[model samples]
Target: MITISNLKKIYNNVLVVNVPQLEIAKGESVGLVGNNGAGKTTLFRMILDLIRPESGEVISNGEAVAGHENWKNYTASYLDEGFLIDYLTPEEYFYFIGGLHQQTQAHVDDFLSTLTDFFNGEILKKGKYIRDLSKGNQSKVGIASCLLQKPELLMLDEPFANIDPSTQIRLKNMLKSMNKQHGVTTLISSHDLSHITDVCDRILLMEKGRIIKDIATSSSTLAELEDYFAVGQSATLLPQIDEEENH
Candidate 1:
């Protein structure tokens, strides 16, 4: 389980996050949706212990995540290109990450075999360094690498952003299976309300660094979120619909 209490982050006198309390039970899939600067990435960083909060604590599996190393054994995340080793080829990078998780070469190979369809034959043995791959392919590599660890907790920020539609569907299916079969807990932050609603069992809406709405996914969830964004045009909602209509 994940727990946050009195979490707060400040930057140059501006508050980035302020959540009095929150909890995500084991094996739950949660999606975070918000406009830019809504503090989604900052909050993910805090959860990963990549950044320190001004005050509050994050507990993972009964351990304080802020100053603990045990959580690393069961947690995996892919936030952005910054998380990858650009100099290494995809295979090399995967092996390195696998080793870190105590996975052997055979274990890594078995994991990568399952992702061939997701990679679409464009990633493996391409003889291209990670930096040389297109943004979408790079995203595929990063995501696949994260799963190679077989982590109990998986966190991804915008896993659907740059990938093509086919791969997006593949990833969504993969994540769903992981959650249902392996019982992996997942936290995903995305701008696509449709995709998030499709994959997540629960959704969170954030604005101004605060969670304003939390709802379990249902038939009405997507429409409700769309309505919220439509009426909130001036709120800087993502891919904001323009006034011009296509005829």
Candidate 2:
């Protein structure tokens, strides 16, 4: 559903993203695993045309993404709370997103009912604006609103961040079900190896600004990534076990 070629992004003379060519097929769940400065978000912004690439182009279903509006008709993305209107309640936000795709309020309500497990009862009818919710709750709202669109292509950056372990599992299951039931193509970028390996059909390991590893998710993908990251190659890997998070 997506093709990229000669894509490049530079910030302050440092090339942040420079992919020569990449393609993601329809109905494929792909995961991008890399530490900070790996160019995941930069690549995403370029794909969405939120940032102009230094060179080359992204093609979404045969249409160039940089100057086209039609690809967005089938795409929905959530990178952070920036995608959400903080002033709106969860219900209002979901409705607004759904309405953009011509979905009715009744349709959004029915769809949200299916996401109760993912929400864990904190998202709806709480009478709280989205800005007032906890960070994790805000993530839930963003993700749920994305799914409500029934998008053909979905991109989520760090979906696992700030979410509790239990909700994380629920989200993994929900993503899996979405792929199986609706054939939604998914792209998830994360530092969490376990969850990404468990959920994605394929994993792309990125470093600096290039894709270094592209492997099909398999029986040993987790162990292989762990072993690859265990070498403490300061040039390649981030230090494991961030101390600040523990405190």
Candidate 3:
């Protein structure tokens, strides 16, 4: 559903993202894993057109994302708390987003009703603005808002960083269901290896603004990722490990 070509983003002459080509098919769940400064978020921003790429273009459904509005209709993303309107209450923000999608208040309410366990009874009717909530709660609000849009393509950045363990499990289940049953294409970047492996069918390992490894999730994928991260500069060792595992 998305295609990128010759993508490059630089800051002050330092290349931050240098993806030459990448493609995501419809209904695929892809996970991005990397340490700090891997340019995952920069790649996401370029895909969302929130920032213009220095060299290339992001294509969504055959149209350039850089100067197009059509993709916004089916794409929903929550990168951080910055995506939320801090001054607005969670309910108000959700309703506003619902209105933008032409969903009635009743529809939104029904949709939120399914998230009672996911919210853990802390999100709705809290009577506090989004900013007043703790970071975890704020993350919940942002994620809920994205689900409210019923997007075809969903992108989330570090969704497990905040939130309690219970909520993380719930979110993972929700993502899996969205992809398996509802066919929502998902792109999630997370530092949590176990969670990402459980939720995504494919994993992209990025380093130094480049995609160093793109592996289809397998029984040994988690161990491979762990080894790669454990031995920071030994990325060249992954292929040997993979071959050994296969044999």
Candidate 4:
């Protein structure tokens, strides 16, 4: 459903994202895993066309994403609280989004009704603007808004970070159902290894602005990721300490 070629983003003369090529098929659930500064968000922004890449292009359904509006019709993304309309109450914001997608208020209400457990009784009818909610609640609002769109391609960054554990579990089930049953193509970036492994069918491990590993999820995917990050932490620290000693 998405293709990227020669994509690159640079900041402060440092290349933050450098994907030579990547492709995501329809109805596939892909997980992006990386530590901070690995350029996962940058890559996502380029794919979403929120930021222009320094080189190359992203293509959705055979059309170049840059300078194109058609992809937005089928794509829904929530990277952070920045995606929210902070001044609006959750209900208002949801209704506004629903209007954009030609969904009636009744449709939105019915959709939200399915999320009672996911919301854990904390999101709706709170009578507070989105800005007043805690970060976790704000995240819930953003995610629910994305789901309201019933998007063909869904991308969420660090979606598992803020909410409580039960909500996280609910979200995983929702995403899995979307991918398997509803055929919603998903790209999720998360630091939580176990949850991502459970939700995604394929995992892409990124480091230093490039995709280093792309593995199809299997029984041992979580263990493999754990080992990589565990050893990776030590390897990174040892290099810095060695450099300091040499200095």
Best by TM-score: 3
Worst 10 residues of 3 by lDDT: 233-242
- The TM-score values for the models, in the order shown, are 0.93, 0.92, 0.95, 0.93
Q: Which should have the higher TM-score, number 1 or number 2?
A: 1
- C-alpha root-mean-square deviation, candidate 4: 5.3
Q: Give a tens-digit lDDT track for model 4, residues 83-135.
A: 99999999999999999999999999999999999989898998999999999
lDDT for model 4, please. Answer: 0.92
Write the residue-wise lDDT of candidate 1 on 129-224 in tens digits: 999999999899889988898889999999999999999999999999999999999999999999999999999888889877777999988888
RMSD of each: 6.4, 6.6, 3.0, 5.3
lDDT (0-100) at residue 62 of candidate 1? Answer: 99
- Indicate which candidate wins on lDDT: 3
Ranking by lDDT: 3, 4, 1, 2
Identify the superior model by lDDT, candidate 1 or candidate 3.
Answer: 3
- Measured with C-alpha atoms, the lDDT of residue 157 in candidate 4 is 98
Backbone Cα, N, C clashes tallied per candidate: 0, 0, 0, 0
Instruction: Give the alpha-carbon lDDT of every model.
Output: 0.91, 0.89, 0.94, 0.92
Q: For model 2, how does the per-residue alpha-carbon lDDT over 54-149 read when each residue is reduced to its tens digit? A: 899999999999778999988989999999999999999999998898999999999999988888989999999999999999999999888888
